[model samples]
Target: MNKIFSLLTLLFMLIYLPSQANDFKAVYELAGRHFPWLKGKVDINPLENKKQGDAFTIEVVQNRLKIEATSTSAASRALDWYVKHYAHQSISHMGNQIKNVSKLPLTNGKISQSSFVPYRYALNYCTINYSFSFYTWEDWEKELDWMALNGVNIMLAPVGTEMVWYNTLIKLGYSDQEAKAFIPGPAYTAWWLMGNLEGWGGPISNEMMQQQVTLQKKILARMDELGIEPILQGFYGMVPHDLKKKIADADVIDQGNWVFTEFKRPGIIVPTNKQFENVADVYYDELKKLYGSDIKYFGGEPFHEGGKTAGVDVPKVAQAVQTSMQKHFPNSTWVLQGWQNNPSDKILAGLKKENTLIIELFGENTNNWERRKGYNQTSFIWSNVSNFGEKNGLYGRLQRFIDEVYRAKNSEFGSSLKGVGIIPEGINNNPLAYDLMLDLAWHAEKPNLDKWIEDYTVYRYGKRNPKVVAAWKEFIHTVYNSPVDENGKVLYQEGPSESVFCARPSLKVNPVSSWGTRKRFYDIERFKKAVAVFISASKDFKGSETFETDKVDFLRQVMSDKADLAYSNMVKAIEGKDQETIKSSSSRFIQMLKDQDELLQSNSYFTLNRWLNQATQFGKGLPDAKLAMYNAKAQITFWGPDNNPKTTLRDYAHKEWGGLLSSLYLDRWNLFVERALAGQTVPPAEFYQMEVEWSKKADLYKPAKSNKKNLARIQQDILK
Candidate 1:
């Protein structure tokens, strides 16, 4: 009996303990790095059945805490649970919600928890550029820790794809300079990977590419330590648009213009062509040499966003792409974005169903998963693109997220539902949106909103003040509310309500970005009431970073709403020929913008200086610091191909940051006011020129020197 038990223990260690992929000791070291007090006070033990799926337990034995978890990811989550439920402290993308304690709190008993799913995924390809474009190793260190604590085991880390492409292009008979031309700048890699446009933001310096490659190495090392599997950008027949100009042998299809006629999309090499597999082989070989051969997932979207597929044999091409991927990384899963008709019926018909995973993108507004019958029984993650262009506004389909997730989990195709994920185009805003969605992976049934949100508030704001808690409850039904149809699908909303303040000033301004909603969907009065209550509790959380950051965020929303009202009144006055009303309202509107800029200074995260500074800082050792700066400015303003004024994507990534609000956005609105008062048509050409000029300016555009008011005073002023 003793011999049999010992053999069973040895088998269990070999089967379930991830001592090779990631060690339990590393999780202890990670905890030590984060909280110094936890260095000698905790022990992390590995479980014996991780194949049964991820789970964790917390207990205290003779004062020292113990965490028994199936994997490093689960252990990290267990620590996070202890911190939130017992210690009453938590960390988030925004900031830490912490308070001084006499001693570390322990669980009441052996509290155990388990996840129903095997994957907890995070990030969209665009998130790499939108939120982390300028991130140094220091920034990624924190970001990875946050991800691990949140139980995200699968992440998209397609940074440094330029290096892989550069080498592949060079091997395929291109000069060094020519190869570099194919790679985009740091700010434009997302679209380049999606094959939308190539070389638009480019020719990133060779030194910068190497730095990013090294950065990715470090990123991967940390992810491995924390049990995160990275999804890399796979080669799916996309080559540089100009590649056909040089390589006349291969048949390359012209994808024509992307969003605008100015930027040409990359050409696709049909799988039937001899060079298709040849290019893919070189691409993957270069990828393996640089990044390592342990990768198990690849992300590539063919025919994404209206790319031409006329001549391509859709099914054959799909099969060829997957075959090449499998040849490179055996047993790997192909991660496809189920957006619109992508991974279409033709594409799905050719693949090995068991090895494919579709991220059901646009879950906030679309039901492509159910409509297509669980993506035709292929495994998929129920996901949401909560924000677009990293824009700021409070929005989330709170209840509908729960409803839709469970609705799918209980459906006939439930076995195909593998997990949950957040694929926001930009992930810089709305922590609750990401946190709540990710949290659902651990539960088997619908979470009690009242209980979950109350706990969320506690961890989100250290010790939650009653006023703040009450305000959040109201917030649930207001800005965070999702009006669903009888089938549990939300009414169409493309991300949050676009701020009227960010829009290029016009009497007919609907949304700041193209393809965004023209109407505000929630009750303005209820939202204001919540904000006021949130502010009332500020006195208790005076020095808290989380509280202060939220203060800036909440107040920004109020000012944006106020700006809309001011703009509307001015537009009415101008039409009625009420000269006095027009002058007063216009002047007040400009003043409101000035006040908004000042209010944004309360949080550095909400400031333009931080973004621009990161850009210039990233370019410190590079040949030209100005190029990075130009990319940063261009992304937010003109979003350029330099000379194109008719580009529809202007102000698509418009930020409501401090320095930017006062400068470029202010100047645009000021011009509109001047034109409105004079009854002159505000020339769109003139505004585009201003945007062009702003993008070209060498100045860093730091915040103005002013007597900044307290957040409370700013709130009052915004209300008035």
Candidate 2:
């Protein structure tokens, strides 16, 4: 009788629980579709872990997978954990590694993991434009899947705010042209949202506005299904700079041009004014009508980067802003970016402590959490902006990421450390950094990365290759390395080390992007050796997607570094007036660029055609298709304030893609080299004209044939 009872219980456990399936249909379907092998082999049950934040337990027994999760997000993560560990697969921006598995691996015992903090956040305002500005529903579907697998519970999703503003502006008696002019182009929306610049890339069509609205609805639905929260853009006093012109009595404050003198920043209407509530009500009402009323978080800031904050009663103004936010959606949290001093003590003083959350944005560089005492003890997340302008490089201070998280949790204001985040300007690079950082959210104690990285290798490339593992270990100590002060604060550096190949030709060059550096803080020779080791394993993973993608990126990096040497040699040759040396060095530099371009062509992610083609495809059937293409080109080259060479924003979005290198960067170098060799003067400022003209040209810099067949031989040659 006892044996019969146990067998019945086992039968019940092997089958799907109806309650769990009904409650988490999204997770069930996600697993079923993403991993078909787990269709009926999976059972999800609810587990309460309120105190420990979202938690999950995986029990793979008797050739079936059973999961007990605190939330749907947790369940999704559990599915991913199973895929990576038992199934030996990985899902990342670099590539997804789900191979043909005949049978699932059974675990000897149950596996459980919980978050160290209550909230897991992701995305940056810049990430919206720099990474996902032109993303379609298909793009967003994959993105949300990646988010769920990584356990990102809350994210900044300001996709359809354009329509909200348009509606609100139209109601205020603005013309259609005037309203669309307030919005930015597709590629330049990040700065527009930030109130830095307005209407640079756009005068978008009504069709595109509707497209965003539809896309956002799908995104929000998926987020809801995955148990991820969306932080909508809120009413924070940003209005078109011509608001005074439209409404003569409007209490509009003049916001000076941002960085560049020509580009106009949106005006701010003080929340203390009667017009503030009026405008706020319309914005929030339209927001609710367009999106939904269930949103509990709002993201908007005043005087971001640079704005005239003079004579504004910041405390009262801030108090009114939060009051308006809560009044619109009672008990909603106001999300503030802890970027520089935008959220000054004056700004913090006016908010309700329990209702505000600060995203401590540059944790890798600044100890703002510590310096501000955990954002004035108002509940903050320890976050890192690892990448700026989405520039590609093998970066992320892996040790610093670990050290800072632990440091915050053990600090005096540890109680206020709510979670971890990945807020890269562009989140397309450094798979190792993102994977390690996201995994940090689930760790209760500091993981000895020496072992953690071993597991990473197995998941990353299907099976752990010794050469690849050794290369990664070397990477962890070299290019991916971070030097910090005694207090674990990083020595100041912006984003990753820049590639000099992207820079315009000069005797002395630094970073391609303004406020960035070309200097390597780590031993370059060690990094080169690591890349060689990585390339050596390419023979084993020749046809592997993840392996080949990384091979291209790693090889591209080493070649970039090699160009610096050629540049230095050429400069030295020029200084000595040695024509023979000049000819040799210049030839090598141009040849190196040609070789690098071909190598980058091996991967679509590293090709210029990919970017332009995306923009072209996105604007398909739209009225401004050609203009849209121009925005894509302009963004990567001389990012504009209307052709001002003195505007430090030029080359701020420089991309070292295959076609870009061959067409633009390399062309510029060839011109510079030719002028030098012929003893002719090279015009410095005249290049801006060439850049603008290139941006306006409606031609595709299509990816030509790459030497993919000879990739291994060429990679070996790079080391030689």
Candidate 3:
């Protein structure tokens, strides 16, 4: 009997213990589907070692590159490894332009490398809303491919979660109308998930909601095949504010409003309540039915971003939530965003350290992981969120990222520091920042920045121009390498110091966003010199799209930075009642706007129409298309209902994109200049009114294309 039982156990192990598919079929299929350009050039095959973490071997034999890995994502990353190191290429979160070299670099033998991190991750809650709320399957395919290439094996994939919530709510004894009322629209779902506000940007069409579920199915399948782990939204006791009305016996807390506003937040279902288990069962049952049973990571923040925790035992409630998750998906990791005062100590005590992953969200501005002791010994990822709301700006503390990630890896809490991640609110700017952060996953120690950048410039523009290299070095010292004082206070403004041109007309121009400062942290003349150097190489690199794009961007900043000096003169003229001088200063400021618009139009990455068109196109053929356009415009602009001028959230997601600078910002400045000249009161009412009208329009604007010569001419004109 014992011999028979041993034989049966061995058979069971063979059937079940191999958790991973351990094949390149799925990966090869993904490559053929998404990046068909790489079909004949690259080939993937499985490595024999199944127990090892995602590792790969790359070799170029007879011009056919064979990549062997433990998994498909590993294989994909191996391809990226070759592209980045051998071919002198870069694929970043900001832009996707991999140079196709006709001649391949010769690889000696099989070159092997393994991931230092168990998990490489991406995205922020704001990222979903700011950048990807309008993503189609094609958009998602490209993004997932980029993620895999960047070695992002675990990502927050919460697309169509609103629909899941809607479906689950209906199953749990709620009417369809109640369910629809509970769900926020596409643009505002991120905050809704965070328990910030509920039902704000809604009246979501059924068509749109259904479309999301279908889209999510594809996203999940692709992610699974690519070896990228999809972190789904877990049940964390957030229910519709009207949950009590729908489920009479539901023990829910009425979290009043978010950020001292009249905006109602979703109700928190008390976790200790026996009803919590029942609701969770229903929720997870639906989750598994919709997505699948293979999910290994779950993300949900209880009492996120200042959500109320009154009348409950914090630790016990946390325990209950985790218990529910573990009960449904045994041994699954619970992911938490390490934002301000989040995943409180009391809550952390309740969680099992091994199963919890904390994302240190604001690594650019604050070192929460280091301060919080790695969330009291729970596993954490050091993340860099250099951009917010996909706001257009060229800024990042690159050296700080390298220093901190190295420190964390070598610190006393190094064992608990699991990985590095890029959690940008928007992932479209500062390509160098993302590449450097992700590169941390490969190196055990700090990479020589000077040497790394030399290679980066080569990959960025195909060949190294001495002037271009000097410019980048200057950028690294001035913008990317910000100085910090004692107590970790950076001697720099937060979130891309607002350009004076983008600010509301005032004698004293403060930052556009509340937490931001108008202080110019770096030397303006030094930054200008860097831009001049880059433009000088435009003749040599005129054919390179990457070079031209970056050149135009540099010129745009040069024009924007000069606006402060012009604004200062304008203020002096206004104070002296000198109409002629005021007109002259105002004319210069207006000219700067025109130049910026033209420069930005030269690249799709910098164009305002890219964002607006994507948002509007999402609501195409729907009755509420106009409403969708309004939501998109409002998110990037006023960011609140017109009733609240004093709302702090307004302008938090502001962008200085091309069309916006040309239209909305220009109109505001034009009105301000006229009022100042006429000695009329310049209240914000007219500008606000104009903004509302602008948001209502759905007209498309084509981005004007300009060549490198044109860009260089413009740069010279601006600088001169």
TM-score of each: 0.95, 0.96, 0.93
lDDT of model number 1: 0.84
lDDT (C-alpha) at residue 386 in model 2? 89
Taking the tens digit of each residue's C-alpha lDDT, what string does model 3 give over 1-720?
999999999987887554333366666665565444556677667776554566889999878778888777778888777776777665554444465556568788889887677778899888889989888888888888888887888999999887788778888888877788888777888888888787767778878887888899999988887788899999999988887776788889888888787478888999998878888998998888788888889998778867778878999988888889999999998999898888899899888888899998888778788789878988999997888777667788888888888888888888888888999888877788888888778776688888888888887777778998999999998767667777867664456767666665666667676666666667878988888887788788756767767876677777777878888887888888889998998898788777788788877777778887887678788777776777888787777665666666666777777787887788888988898899874766666667767777765566666666866667777777
Tens digits of lDDT, candidate 1, 575-652 = 987779988988888888887888886678788888888897888888857788889888988887777777888888
Q: In lDDT terms, which candidate is top? A: 2
Residue 207 local lDDT, model 1: 91
> Residue 127's C-alpha lDDT in candidate 2?
91
- Candidate achieving higher lDDT, 1 or 2: 2
Q: What TM-score does candidate 1 get on C-alpha atoms?
A: 0.95
Number of the predicted model whose TM-score against the real structure is largest:
2
Worst 10 residues of 2 by lDDT: 705-714
Clash-forming residue pairs, model 3: none
How close is each model in CA RMSD to the real structure?
A: 3.3, 3.1, 4.7
The segments of candidate 1 whose C-alpha lies over 4 angstroms from its true place after superposition are: 1-22, 100-102, 485-489, 704-711
Ranking by lDDT: 2, 1, 3
Write one digit per residue (lDDT tens) for candidate 2, span 248-293: 7778888998885868899999889888998899888898999989
After the best TM-score superposition of candidate 3, give how far the Cα of residue 350 lies from its true spot, in angstroms. 0.9
